[model samples]
Every structure is written in C-alpha cells, then in structure tokens.
Target: MPTLPISLVIITYNEAGHIARCLDSVPFAAEKIVVDSGSTDDTVAIATRHGAKVVQQPWLGFGPQRNFATTQATHDWILVLDADEYLSPELAAELERRLPTVMAGAAAVGILRRSTYYMGAPMRWYRPMVGERMARLYHRGRARWADVRVHESLRWEGSTVDFAAPFHHLHNPTLVHKQLKVLRYAELKCRDWLEKGKPVRMWQLPLVFIAAFLKDYLLRLAFLDGWRGFAVAHTAATYAAYKRLRYFEMRRNPDSVALAQAELIRYRLER
Candidate 1:
C-alpha cells in the first residue's frame, strides 16, 4: 500500500527502548520527524536508522516540545505520537481508509487510546471522565498543543471527527517506573501552578483525593477492569494529592522548591 501524505512528529529524550516500535507502527506516514532533546542513550541513532529525520533540541516542557515538533513536519497533516504509543492494526487500517474523507470537513481526528498498566492487560476503562479520545492526527494550521508544563492537550476550533479504533499505549510496565513518573509529573504540575501564581490549597487535599478517586473508580467505570482498574484509580488519586501536597510543602519550605527544580532539570536530562 502506498503511504499517505502525512508526517509523523514525535518528541523524545532517552527513548531508545521504544523508539523502534513507535517508528515501525506508522508505516503509512510519508515522512517522520523526531525532535529529540539531548539523549545520553542511543535514541537519536535508532531513530535515524529507522529513516526518521532527527532534530536536536533541548527539553522545552511537554506541550512546547510537541508544538515545536509540529512545526518541523513537511506535511500539513500531522500525527503526533509518544514514544510509548503506536497505532493498533485496526486503527492503522482505519486511519488509512478514512483519513482522506475525514480531512475534507474536519479539523482533527480523535482516536481512542487503549492503555496498559504495570505489564498487565490493557484496561477497558481508563480515566473515562477525561475521555479516551485523543486528538492526535490533525492539520497543524488548525490545532496546537497547550503551553502547559505537564498534562498538555491540543486545542482547536471547528469540526472534529473520531476514528472508530483504539490506539495502543504501552505505558510504564512496572510499579517503580510508574511511581517515578508520578513524582515527576506531580512536581511539574506543581511548578506550573506556582508559575501561574496559584495559591496553595492545603485544605483541599483530602477532598481532592476523595473526589479524584471516586471520579475514576466509580464515575469512570474503572471497576470494570478489576484490580488493575482499582490500582489505576488509586494511583491517579495519589497523583492528585501529591501535586497539592508538593505545592503546600513548597509554600511552607521555600528551599524545597529549589531542590525540586533541580530534580526536574535532572529528570529532563535523563528521562
């Protein structure tokens, strides 16, 4: 089958372990661009070997990094993917068959993502409140990622369509790995809030944790996935709590904020 006139844009830092699978999954892309921050590993070499045009860039937060990658694409239609994410066979086929027709009237294509946990089976429900629909494929002119430090998303106007398939997300497969990521993400979110001059909400910690847990476990139907679902909800609640706790800590002990900032810089370099 001939490839589509689309460019695959990915941002990476020390992603050698997963880059190959990510690059191989998108065989339909006419071109692939990898905007990599300094990687101590062989991430750049592996991407280059896989026929991707690799651009060296410094870490610029999650949202900014993705936006910068979109600008490097040769094609107007872009597919933004994470190093741990790839298209499932059904989704790949659906994308090739439907994208041309969808693009005629839609600004972006929202694909459902099926994510796994701790090397276990993929969860049937993961954060349903937020919706599993991810706007990954889009015209760069109409969509761009929000300039946030952590949880970033593409914002766009006009009509949008959904692909009736699920993209595979092989997320952190171990508890240790997941915990480290949670810490990093929570810190980043706290930093963003601090930068925005948001006040510390110490009193809301318990309420936030309870609300987040119930939202994921009950409202999101995470219970359907069994223990894995419970773990997911529990972890998510912990994250919500931690972000607030970090803010509270930073406000009480200003020196801790500097330590976290240094840790974040180290994480950016090594992550």
Candidate 2:
C-alpha cells in the first residue's frame, strides 16, 4: 500500500505553549505549515525548529486566516488544526489507515469527533452529539471556510467521511483562561452583530439567556458531566446574553461605548 501524503496547516499567534506538542503529534505529515499572525512570543521559532515552514501575516479574521493557511500548503490534502488541538495516537493511526481509502474515494472532506478538555480533564458529557464533530480535513481545492468572524464552518460540495477516532482538544487550560476566552468571543460576536446591523431587542435578553442555559444543561445533557458541565452551560448562556447586552448598550449609549473602546485600547497598549 502506498502512503497518502498530507499537509498539516495551522494558524497561530503567541501559541508557543502548544506548538511543539501539536507539531509532534503529526509526524506523518508530508509538510507542516504554520501561518502566524505576528506572535510576540517564540511561536515562530518553535514552529521553525519543529521543521515547519512558518509564514507571518497580520491578523486576518479567523476564517480568512484559515483559508490563507490552506493556500500555503504544497499538498492537495490538508488537515487544518488549531494550535491547542492535537491528534490522539488512535486518531493518528486511524488517519494513516484511512487516508488512502478516502483519497481514492469521491469524498472531498473528512469529519472527526473532537473531545474537548477543560483545565486538563475531558468534558465528557457536554453537548456530546453536536459540539464534538467538526470537518477539519479536506482537499484544498474542494472546500473553503466561510467568511465569518466567529463560528465559521467549511463550505464543501462533495461527499464527506467521518473518522472513528476523536481529536483531543485542550479547550481551556484554566478557569481564568476560560472566562477570558468567553468574554473575548462575546466582544467579537457583538462587533460582528453590530456590523451586520442585527437588531437586539433588550426584552429578549433574559429569555435568550434562559433558553441557552436550558438547551445546554438539559437538552444537551451537560449535567451528566457534573460541575464542569454546569459551568460550561452557564458560561455559554452568559456569553450569549452578554454579547447581546453589550451590543444593546453600545447602540443605546454612545458615551458608554466610547469609554469601553478607550479602556480596550489602554489595555492593549499596556499589554
């Protein structure tokens, strides 16, 4: 059997902490490409040392950045991965066995289940069915990421295959990091909503939050995971509510928006 060639593509900024582990996990890759967006840390150096071709570009939005990285790959088959994610041993073996078949078949995209971990432990019962699966492997010419700022997905017209082994995602390393991530995502969501002229009704704020909590905690069976499940559900609900509330506040009070913008600028400068 002939080996299937694949290019591993990743986009990063200040991801020196996980770059080594991520690169180490995919030793079978024919080429490793890291498209960095001006990392202040040793991300570039780490990737280069790991035998990856590193390219620097300014921060494009998430979808654009991923698409840009795909363009740099020399192989036809590309596996897009986040800096905080890595292939499990089982997954790597599965890929090695399955890629040849997939390449010969008509499938243009490959989907895999991703098991997310919070603070070093897996969130086993959180939205098990819906949030776990993603399309990360695809032929570069057959698929492209949507042009959205947050929650972007791939657009593919061909058939897709689902791999059995799951990818390990180190979602949040700590509670503090989780909180910051939720807030930053909320901010970007609010900005995107405002740009798209999406109207937020102040009256729907509480209702939306309640619905989000119920959907995740009850319907999604987050409670089955214990305290971490509850925390995940609550944080997701809070993120949804906060983004809407922030958008409303910004639209209603320009003075508050100005102050918030100034504070953000000051914080960035200080950092």
Candidate 3:
C-alpha cells in the first residue's frame, strides 16, 4: 500500500532535549518543516540532523508562528506537532491510513487525542482541558489558526473526524518546570486580556480561583489520581488566580505595559 504524502510542521525554541525524538516519531512524513525562533541551543542543529528543513524566524506569538510554518510546507496536507509531542505508533499508522480519505475531502480536519505525561508518567486524572483533543491535521488551504497567544486553535468550516489513537505529550518533567510553564502561560494570558481591553473583576477573584480548583479537582476527578492529581489541580487553580492578579496589577499601575514587555523580553532571552 502506498502512503499518503503530507508535510509535518513544527515550531520550536530551545527544544534540544526533545526535537530529535519528535522528528523520529514521524518517519512517515514526506517533508518536515521546523520554524524556529532564535535558540542559543542545539535545537536547530539537531532538527537539521533529523532531516527537518529548519527556518529561522523570530517569535510571532503561537498562532501567527504556526500559520507561518504552514505556509512553508511543500504539501497542502499538514500535521502540526509541538516539540514535546510525538505520535504513538498506533496513531502514526492511523494517520497514514486516513490521509487518503482526508485528501479526498471526506473531512477538512483530523482530530487527535493527546495524553500528557508528567515526570515521565501519564497523568491519569489531571488531563488538561484545552488539549484533550486537537485539530492538528488539516488542509492548510482550508484552515487557519485563530489569533491567540496561549491556546490557539485551528478554525475550519468543513467536517472533522477523530483519530484512532492518542499522541504522547511529554510536558511537565519536573514540579519546577511545571510551575514555570504555568507562570509563562499565565503571563501570556494576562497580556491577551490587556490587549482585548478586558477588565479584571477584582471582586470575583477569590471565587474564580475556588471555581477553578473545584472544577479540576472534583468535577474533573483529579482526586482519583492521588497526590499528583491534587498538585495538578492546585497548580491549575493558582494559574487562574495569578493571571487575574497580574491583570489587576497591570490595570492599577501606569507603567504596567512596559513592565510586561520587559518581562516577556527577559523570558525570551532566558529561554
């Protein structure tokens, strides 16, 4: 059986530790494109060694950067994967099987379930709500990423279908790493809020945190995973609270935007 031709597009910055594994997992791809922001690491070299065409571009936020990468692909059928994510063998085979149907216009997008690992183990109860299922496989001409920084998603008018298996996401390898990830994401969220002129509801701050905790812990069944679950739930709640607090602080201070910009600069430099 002949395999379907597709381009695998990935965006990276300082992902030296995981890029090779990510590229290796997608041996079926006809072409691999990696759009990288400036990295003072071995990310670009490793990706090139793994047969990915590496393009150097400065950070343009999540959605915009992904859109730029898609344009550089040789094929219309594109599969976007993060540096820390890779397809399971089952999922890879499923993609090879389904690509023909997708190219025939049966569906405009293919959704895949992602199972996230924390500290080298799968998180049984604390699955992130945003990435449960993602439309990572799509025809570039028919879809585009929404213009959001933290949790951008694909926008398409056609039908979609789910893949048979899940992709593996090695996200949080350590507690400190997890915290830093949350902080960075929260900072981006706060910036988005400020950009949209969204006002912070100072009065509902406590309630917002409480609701986040309950939803993740009780409603999402994070408790079933034991101490790790609790930690995930607590961290999620704290992220929500921190974003709100950051937004409020920005709203109150006259020099907040400058401060935020400085912090983002520092973040990019450190990474």
Candidate 4:
C-alpha cells in the first residue's frame, strides 16, 4: 500500500522563541496548521515564515485549542505537536519509514516527551525531565484531548505503540516561570478536584505531595536526569501542597471580610 501522507498540527500562544525551532523539524508534512490563542509575540509570524498556516483564536484552554487545530487540518492522519516540543532526529526517521504501515489500526502514536527544566541558573542539582508518553499523531477523528483542564489525556479508541524515539520538550527556562506554571496548574487541578468532591484534609496535602514526589522524582526515574530531577521532585510536591491548601481555603471559609475584597481584587488583576 502507498504511504499515508500526513499533516502536522501545533497549538501556540506567545511562543515566539520556540515556534520556528518546532516547525523546523517537519518541513515535509503535507500541511502544518498552527492554531494560535492570541499571541502578542512574533509566534504567528515565525510559524508563517516557516510555511505553516497560522490561525488566530481566543484562549480556549489546552484540549480545545488542540482539537480546534485538528479541525483546521487538511488530512486524516495528524502529528500533533506543542510549540515548545520538537521531534528528535531518530523519531523523525522512524516515523517517516514506519508510520504509514501502522496508521490505519493505530488510533494514535505514543512518543516519550522528554522535558528539560532549569532554575535561576539551570540547577545542576535539580533539573526535572519531562516524563510523559503522549499520544500525538492519530487519525483525524480517532482521538481528542480530554476535557479536564490539567494533565488531560487523549481520549483514544484503538491500539497504540511504545514509540522509541523521544520528543524534546523545553519546558521552563528559568525558576520563576517554572514556579508560576506549576502554580497555575495547581489552581486548575484544585478546581478539578473540587468538582469531583475530593476531600480537602490538611493532612492530605503532605500525603499527596509526598506520594506525587515519589512517583515522579523516584519511581519515574526523573532523578536520572540529575539537577533537573531534584527541581521536578520539589516542584511536584509544591504544586500538590498548593492545590490542597487552596481547597482548604475554600472549605474552611476564611471569614475575613476585608481579605475577601482583596481576594476578588487580586483575581481581577490576575485575569
């Protein structure tokens, strides 16, 4: 059978520094659709300069943005990518050689997204690597990102493969951004937990934090990456702690009327 020509899709938002590097890897994709969520930076220009079609849209969260990117594509088989991620050379060659044969039965392709993290100075003692095998390439209608706002998985409906090649994900270049991103994720996660009626015991904070720390930093072998590992371990624990703390804040009902006004003001400022 002839090979399945594919389209590579990417979602971007203020990713000026990384978009060009991302689009650089798959120049031969039959089509490349970049769904942007109002990037004030040159992300759109960079993608367009690379011969990709850039579609600007509102911030609709992660899963929906990705799904919208799929809708704008011109082909059934899609190679979904994050603007901060890029295909490694080994994966690219393997995908070009074998992807077509496996395209039909496979609803998605699993690729390990190797993350790189840094501190104020690229922490030699605590670098956390991306430990995820995400479903990227798939049939047009076979899968979509789940509705959950944080750590959402692909809603897939068929067989998958443990693709050996890794996808490079340059997560956070500095400690400030890293901490900020995790906190944002923590807020979303707390909302998810609250929606599900999850308990908000103060004790649950340390327990969940420690457990998540162990799973990612130790069990997932995130420590193998050295400094990046320690940072990840620490961040995972911090995020859990923050989420549980927020949950308690709402549960216990902080009765300071003045603070309530301040909270609303802060919320408006952040948004």
Model 4, 45-122: lDDT tens digits are 889999899888775666666777778988888888778788888877778777767765644554444544344322
Candidate 1 structure, TM-score to reference: 0.92
Writing each residue's lDDT as its tens digit, candidate 3 over 1-271 gives: 3435899999998999999999988888989999999888999999999999999988888888899999899899999999999999988888888777778875778889999887567878665632488889998878999878778989997888888688989976789888877777777777789889997798988998999999999998888878877887899889888888888988888497677678767766323
Query: How many steric overlaps are in each model, in order?
Result: 0, 0, 0, 9
How many pairs of residues in model 2 come into backbone collision? 0
Off by over 4 Å in 4: 1-4, 104-131, 222-226, 252-271
Which regions of candidate 2 fall more than 4 Å away from where they truly are?
1-3, 128-131, 254-262, 265-271
With a 3 Å backbone cut-off (N, CA, C), the pairs that clash in candidate 2 are none
Top candidate, metric lDDT: 3
TM-score of each: 0.92, 0.92, 0.94, 0.82
- Alpha carbon deviation, residue 118, candidate 4 (Å): 4.8
Which has the greatest TM-score? Answer: 3
Better structure of 2 and 4 per TM-score: 2
Clashing residue pairs in candidate 4, if any? Answer: 115-130, 125-227, 126-227, 126-228, 126-231, 127-227, 127-228, 127-229, 128-228
Runs in model 3 deviating more than 4 A are 1-3, 127-131, 267-271
Give the per-residue lDDT of model 1 (tens digit) for 224-264.
77887788789999999988888888778879988777876
In order, the Cα lDDT scores of the candidates are 0.82, 0.84, 0.85, 0.71
Q: Between prediction 1 and prediction 4, which has the larger TM-score?
A: 1
